[model samples]
Target: MEGKRVMAITGVHHAQITIPRGAEEQGRQYYCHLLGLPEIEKPESLKGRGGFWLQVGDRQVHVGTEDGVERSSTKAHLAYHVTDIMAWRQRLQEHGFQILDGVPIPGYERFETRDPFGNRLEFIQPLA
Candidate 1:
């Protein structure tokens, strides 16, 4: 077994989203309180930065503050599924989130919203 490749299986341990300056608290509020994800405590080595890290089920979301990059396409947004799509939409609307009425994307109900730093995100639910 020494110096040989083994046939084992593993999956993605995490995913990350980088935001620009001053968006940490907003990201926390949205991902933690609003979306109900558990806030993963950052290691002491990664603290004192201008962003946050959050955990969603088995995945992780890392929000880092960039210096001067311009925000671009919303097409690369993250798509999340919820138990009640309409209710989620309403809740976001009630919180002043800019909701975009998206076209039917073949097999799912979808909508889009922008984060505090202008990063776009999507939410979709499959019709059952």
Candidate 2:
């Protein structure tokens, strides 16, 4: 409380999600090939642990490998802001990713869905 100053928080640098062990290729196919997020090389030290990183806009998403945990049935999730809410809904639905409607928020249109691994994801677009 004295002369100390509080540090201001900045934007997110990265977020992490997990997949079943030895399923990195599947993750890559869904996240990269289908979703269009570019794959970025993993750091040398973190390579042996499995999984890889992807570039989402200016931020990064790290997909890790783990097992036995319930990837679904959790509230923890990542929400990505997009330009077209309807198009994203259609595209993901075409691939059979079930669409879950998000709660109504004033001035926004959004929806939720799961990745192939069952990680909850939200896609939102601002309504002007």
Candidate 3:
């Protein structure tokens, strides 16, 4: 027992989406406008690093800028629970965001959309 490892489960505290430096603008347009998240300024010290913070209710998502990293939808993703799926889809399309129609996630209805840097984002809402 002295070397035993313990796993703790508490709910998700926060999540960060990493994008290439200078791709923050695309994140702002797609996430802030389409998803209705408020953009909070990244600290001045972090400004030069190229990222922005978005406030999503009690959770915070930090979009960070990673230099020279190819955007890959296969690696990481963020799933958001949205109230209005159709409205969000329409708005995102109008803004020229590439959205992929996907099958429902079993217990939940969901779809996928890509950010400017190709980060895969999923929009989901429980089926009534």
Q: Indicate which candidate wins on lDDT.
A: 2
Prediction RMSDs, each to the true structure: 2.6, 2.0, 3.3
Model 3 lDDT tens row, 35-124: 779988778887787788998888889988787766662857788888878887887888887788777567777788888777888888
Q: State how far residue 50 of model 2 sits from its true place (Å).
A: 0.5
Per-residue error for 100 in candidate 2, Å, reads 0.7
Candidate 2's error at 81, in angstroms?
0.6
Q: Please write out the lDDT profile of model 2 over residues 9-94, one tens digit for every residue.
A: 78889999999999999998899998889999998999999999999989999999999979798989999899978999999999
Q: Which residue pairs in model 1 clash with each other?
A: none
User: Which residue ranges in model 1 land beyond 4 Å of their true spot?
Assistant: 1-9, 72-74
Off by over 4 Å in 2: 1-6
Give the per-residue lDDT digits (tens) of candidate 1, residues 41-80: 8899888876787776677778788867655564666677
Lowest lDDT block of 10, candidate 1:
69-78
Model 3, residue 65: distance off in Å is 0.4
Error of 3 at 55 (Å): 1.0
Question: Of the candidates numbered 1 and 3, which has the greater TM-score value?
Answer: 1
Each candidate's lDDT (Cα)? 0.78, 0.93, 0.80
Assess every candidate by TM-score.
0.80, 0.92, 0.79
Cand. 1 Cα-lDDT: 0.78
